[model samples]
Target: MTRSTPHVVGRLSFDPYEGPAGGWGSLSGMAKVVLRSGDLPVDQLMRQNKPGGFMCVSCAWAKPAEPHPAEFCENGAKATIWDLTPRRAGPDFFASHTLTELRTWTDYELEQAGRLTDPLRYDAASDRYVPCDWAEAFAAIGGRLREIDPRAAVFYASGRASLETSYAYALMARMYGSQNLPDSSNMCHESTSVGLTQSIGAPVGTVTLDDFAKTDFLFFFGQNVGSNSPRMLHDLQKAVRRGAQIVTFNPLKERGLEAFTNPQSPFQMLSPATTEISAQYHQVKTGGDLAAITGLCKWLIEADEMARAAGNPALIDHAFIADYTEGYAAFADFCRGADWGEIERESGLSVAAIAQAAAAYARSTAAIGVYGMGLTQQRFGVSNVNMVCNLMMLRGNVGREGAGLCPVRGHSNVQGQRTVGITEKPELAPLDVLKDQYGFEPPRYEGMTTVDVCERVLERQVRAFIGLGGNFLRAAPDSPRLEAAWGSIDLTVQIATKLNRGHLFTGRAAYLLPTLSRIERDVQDGRPQTVSMEDSTSCIHASDGTREPASPNLRSEMAIVAGIAQALLPPNPRLDWGAWRDDYGKVRDAIAQTYPDKFADFNARFRQPGGFHRGNPARERDFSGMEGGRARFILPPGLSAVGFDDAPDVFRLMTLRSNDQFNTTVYGYHDRFRGIQGTRDVLLICAADMDRLGLEAGQVVALETVSDDGIDRRKDGLRVTPFDIPPGCLGAYYPECNVLAPVGHHAQDAKTPAVKGIPVRVRP
Candidate 1:
């Protein structure tokens, strides 16, 4: 592809001279960049930094450096670059661009503009957004909200919102008498939460960052760390250096797992001394993860039996099970009952492969099982996660250093939002505490989740949606359906740093409130402010951005949320909303008081350099659930592996991620790792599958939806590219491919849409 081809994946075409080096050095160097726009070296940026540096509002990953720098990761750079770009959307910009005109732009084009400068309201007659006073916008929104059925108002929270703002938003929604709290988590790791909560008492990861260095074996299932979570590469490298075995089970062979050039090593990047990541790579078929894990468990059980018969030490951790677990006998019985042929067939892996993986786990001193959305976005997503936890519990893997489960989160603050109580179902204790501390009874009704919100909107049961900071309409699945649903709403408010497709899909009396970017300074009560974020490891830290606000008219998310609350609630209310708005410390104080068990003295703790680590129940091996203690394995029912009666022409379509793109955010077109550039329109077909279908590389083919439902959602025109993938499994990008997915198809328990493994038929 020529340079003029409008690269979709920015990093692939990024010139080394345009920024820093391509790999780790570039990442470390960019890490120093202040959250703001100006170009400053790492040392200078750090020197000028106060407490709050530049925090990416998009993701909760904070750059809290003593001396803030302009450097960030490739994805971080993409986020920062997108944030710092010299673009604006003011009244005039909107005046010249009609809502109809803006809708014509692609998702990427819309967000490329820096920030929304003024609060905007859509005018039906003009078909354009007009600037409105903050008070007018707030009052208008409050009035519309009051008119809506309390059950109909769905309040969605993005990870980008500050902990203080998120709390205020949740409180306001509750006070308004709605339980509709749809969040990004519903789309990502709700399965992890559901599955883990069943096995252990919590949904978060059991291990901390410190555990990476201590773990002897690392099992990565259904995740591509290098592209999704690059910072994890550091830990993988560290573990490899320490002689740890990292086994990866994924459908596609990810480049990051094969070898990585540690930019930290002077010679590695300069030369070719790259570190190999995965000791054993298993290309299990899509939807075969559960079966693969089951096979491993079966192998371990057989090993334990063989060892006992040989008069040797017990292969399983029987002591741990007796002292710290429950349901062992049941789990063991289930494992014993698993048929080998069923395991092999369902897992799409051989019995020997399962045995090899099991032997590795049995011999390891400690093992950490890490996964991502790939494991969670399936028809059996919740069961898939439970099986992983079941395997870990059987071997007594929890509550120990280097031995736990890690669900890699996408947005940095996505995990943090949930940590700070952004949920549809807040526990009774937290609810009572919130009421006692704030003097208002939070709505006791269970709130609507993401899917529920979409369905409610479609049914006209939901009239207003106030988004803190996400491209909601586009971020969701069934975009066409969601867009139509959003259009039916009475009021839609988006507080964001940049223009996105969501902003364009506005409702009547819609408001686009501009907010301060994480890099910018947030001041209240004559003091600079910082927001706290909870990382994947359950580490809560303060994030302070260093850049100036894109526009002076922009307000911080906390201020915007509080302002809206003040407008909505009566003056003689239980909570002192005004006081909290004046001082963020007051908000933190409330948070501390509300979550005393988890966060004590939130203000003081946040002052600490790296922030504070929250206590994990599993970390201490405290399985605080039924049976009066220990974690237990919940064995699932076995089924004959579901396989297609091979029609010689049909191929299963597996949705994959391109290196240049994130969930719904496509940065550029090039997937350098996949050796593809300048296009997302191509499909990855196994060479053999292509041959059997009488197709070759670069063959133009149509993918038809093979669902029993008479829905034809696939685009009629798509080019096929023969690539390396397991036979019977084809690869395509998401959102585009999401059309082919049936709305009814989702995880049995978690309700997460099954995006990864979709069965389809190929056409010539």
Candidate 2:
């Protein structure tokens, strides 16, 4: 074995693994064993017979299969291991440790203690939390709310919350005359929602997983399936087996996307078997997705014009454009006028390469375009999505069997919670339906978004915060600012399954209430209960965890929300909280009645094997916009107006996820894709950049983040590792780097921080 010196930074170290012997020849042999052994628990989660089934709550990707006896992914295993760990943060633990001492603990150390046991209050005299009764906690919270201005209160929700819990929480905040409702979506897919809604009349993806299996071509933009959404690899593998051309456009060459071995396939482990996913891979610059996509559209139009002159059929879908789309001429004109030099410079893709991709797209009968945070966390995030929609519109891809748009969503029920009305800005139709069904007037004023809540707290407007499930303080951009904002709040309430960084950042009076994990059985009203999750493919299914609750005292998120509402609300004339709490079925009934067009017989339909898929306007080719057509192409202003201009010696830093971790939480330090092991403190740099800077592959360096507002946020002790990446670009892990992002530096329309693409200068 040829042992190489691994990179080291801070308290972490990275050691590369030498898989077997030979080069590409040995890859097939290694894959065979990986498939047979199914080393990763993620593959097992997708099989049927398992308690939780194949659905991943961490990332909403599901498929129909028998649940394996031991099912979970690396990240899922991390989530389960963390959840099932025999660690407890009880009243005795709190008594032994002061708030000051606990604050000094790392996020990993604090959560290692397991689950929270009882409600506790922070005593300023002793600077420690003491056990308090549930009633006292509620009353104290209510009293604080009554004392503060209504607008001064902020209620935040994490993606772990179920649809029922989210609805109740949203209702509680609105009824209390406050719109300070910040949610997890603000940091992730808010741009997808905003852009798709404006351009396509809906905020969700147009394609289903079935489409992936049937499509002739698959185009991935700014997404890493291996770490961000591993289940997606199964679909990609299927597509590759069917001879579908798979193309990937990302800043890094993700290993999972390059090749994958299906652990479920019996022959995979026994023989030299693996799927080659990316037929063509392009390493686009950070924040350059919009330009790359636009260039593809431009090439498509040019090809169509050329084909038309040859007396052959036009490359563009004229029938679909005429019958279903609007504003085609304007978009085509914009594409015609675009400069190739500008596109090449910004996207870091040669004109010939983009033209080849465009030709492939035009030749294919059906194609699907998928993207993730790389496109959404940029200055013109919404606009980038619009550009993608426009490309699909040009080819009449929407509402087709094998073609449409797919915004790979993060979190299991993030999209489901939004569908059930966890939004800060609820539509008029949903609000009206909710009021009519519940017999209460819903608030008319627009509620606070994630950014709004942070601003409110900074202005001393928000006094109290109640989180359903998430690490908000750590996940949100600008940790220092968020930490100070938390201090300004009078009371903080956290209803969580496990310990996270958010719990350590306490307010004057705080309570850490433990809740049942998603993988644990939830018993309500003397019966086991199962909650529904909506996957990225628009499929809604029931998830029942086999594991027992962490503790008897730990309640479901629904129960906790109900308890708080029952404690705080006056004897209400409308809105029956008691009926909803007795059984979750009542809440489903209300949902069915409110959204009859989509969620009819909500409870009954969810009992099906794979559940039911929601109505997809694009799948049906029913473009229900102002144009009264299918889908139309809308021209974006241009790439010139997108993102910040680079300065001398400044490289755009893009935050990424390791294979062993999820958002905000670090499971392990290893990143298997880049050959990194046992450490996340390494920075991926282009070889050219390292040579230019006179730096070696494993050199220790300090990363200084320069915010748009001229603030200097620095993270020291990052080992630089040279990799295959575009010049003028750098890569690092997130949350730890989230502090370097400016609080105010967000997408123009969506307000999502550009965490994936931030311009910065590195110091030695």
Candidate 3:
């Protein structure tokens, strides 16, 4: 229906953007999305993130209590317009293009083809997808699902699904007697959850949006605020204007963390002036956040002894450590005993750089630590979180008025889905309440994670896959392997808003069901339905649509989940699938019953303008939920930043999202911030590394993953570009470069694919 931004081989532009993160640059990008999509998004854009309006369906960044008139960002606009486009892939479109021909298209091309208008089933003889009646499609899928062992089925959830839909989906999975409910979290913040839970007895972050007001010092690690969450630039600008300190640690010196020009401000937009963001920026090596943080802890502990002996103010919170934490002795001893040489080497920073940050931490009255996927998608991702927790707790940041740890989550409502029982771990869910309410025993056994699903698919153990959302094959590691394994499944169902490459990776019996986006009105039984979302800050708010559906035949996610469940399972009086699908209040009521403490009066609380915070115990310094009833100081695993082989010839390649991309969804071909265009297949390597590898700039190069595992993961035709990254580090766009990250070589504890620090060798 429409052409996407073409991906073609071209000379790369490395002109550094001179302006701030958001200005006319961002506005122009948003305007382009509107013009190209043949859709007018101004009305919907005005309502996004407003009071009683639909939440932005892009990032999970929290909405402020007093939001700006335009609370959405450039990427948010792109996501909305990307969904609201007039292009439709109806029966005619499918008839014109065979499945084999569709498979040859790029991810951008496939998405640009348009949104699916009706339920479709894969036909073997025709080698294409044909429109089918909703009932017939559901019955066929249900019959196939019933034939398979439920345990062999994987129920995947994406972050775009509202809490109500995720709740119903979770119930369906449990009713089907399976707990393989792995969502997008497994690829990104799973390490945050696992590490935070082990250290502080809570899986969620402790910091709230208001903490920015009182925080004088902010420590940002592995997160590009400008690109990842541009709305965060507003808070950074506020903090800067108030003379607060923002110190950033990242491999790349992102423009957003450095400076910002708020698009909402007419004066700034008209002028050349921009607000400076970070007071100090440290370019740490890829996978070196652990060592960098450990160095901070080491410096503080070493300075504490000096201060105490000199009768100066103590550097660390000694009283808090003694009274509210355990294992401080072992943790402190380990840090003090750490070698300065190793810390400097592993962190890719000198002792002076580490000491400067430690000094700022020591002097700060209150501070906050913000991180993202960069810290979590590592070999020792859990350890990375524990170290961040250790650094924050050393200053008593946890439970403080203006200080805590904030993991900036990606994708809207990812955190909310986990809260509402879309999880592989049964212990995390209120299984007893689910049993009492639903009249079924919730699956107790631990289910397969994302990595486990990919691995099992090869062995044919996972026979069926029902994805609520997300491009699993593309987002996952070992793309070629997963894409090949995709067809081996017996049944695969995707409830999506638009076309993605994931739809083409069909199984023997596959169905693509178009669903209403969160921004579209869902009328059930003549009643306009509403749903809820939980932001990264744990603020639960209602998100309902005023815009009509893209297609008349499109169904709501809850309805699709219910349809499948009704066809597969026997009738049960306790579970009211029909009401939950239509009313949505019934779903929220059920969620409230499951987590009464958190979701009490779920329907009422979420109606508030800013919504209600789902209280976190860790913020209150309540460690009773953890072992030994106290926050524990976790010891560092090793002196090395990456807890893997340190081969000299191997380069550390970190997968990244382009400025115009989100996760696996490539919106365009250009990463404007990095000065690249018309392609996503460029490798960013430092000058020193380029010299060592004897590679010329703009030369197409290939990369082979260096792993002990027998599986050889490789990618070719990447144009090498010299960059300002750490000497041994390189950067490449994800999903395109996701091929180099082999399965099973992931964060074993969190099961997150180590996309950030993949060891690779480059060849021309």
User: Which candidate, 1 or 3, has the higher TM-score?
Assistant: 3
Between candidates 1 and 2, the one scoring higher on TM-score is 2
* CA deviation > 4 Å runs, candidate 1: 1-52, 55-72, 426-429, 572-574, 639-651
lDDT tens digits, residues 1-764, model 3?
11122248345465666667889889877776677688877899988888778998899898877889899988988988998889998999999998889888888888888888989999989989999999998899889989999899999999999998898898899999999999999989999999999999989999888898889999999998877888888888998899889989999988898888889998998888899999889999998887788889999998999999999989899888987899999999999888889888888999999999889888998999899889899888888889999999998999988899999999899999999999999889889988888788888999999999999997878899999989998898888887887888999998888888788888889999999988899899999988889999999988879888889999998899999999999999988778778888888888888898999998878888778998999899889987789998998688544556667788888988888877777777667788787788788999998888788987888888888878877787787788889998999888888888888778758989989988899876
For every candidate, C-alpha RMSD to the true structure in Å: 4.2, 4.6, 2.2
Model 1 TM-score, 2 decimals: 0.91
Q: Which candidate achieves the best lDDT against the true structure?
A: 3
lDDT of 2: 0.74
lDDT leaderboard ranking:
3, 2, 1
Tell me the deviation in Å of residue 4 in model 3.
22
Candidate 3 vs. true structure, TM-score: 0.98
lDDT of 2 by residue, 355-425 (tens): 88888888888989898988888878888888888888888888888999999988878887778777777
Comparing 1 and 2 on lDDT, the stronger one = 2
Give the Cα lDDT of each candidate: 0.73, 0.74, 0.87
Alpha-carbon shift of residue 31 in model 2 (angstroms): 18
Q: Estimate each model's TM-score.
A: 0.91, 0.92, 0.98
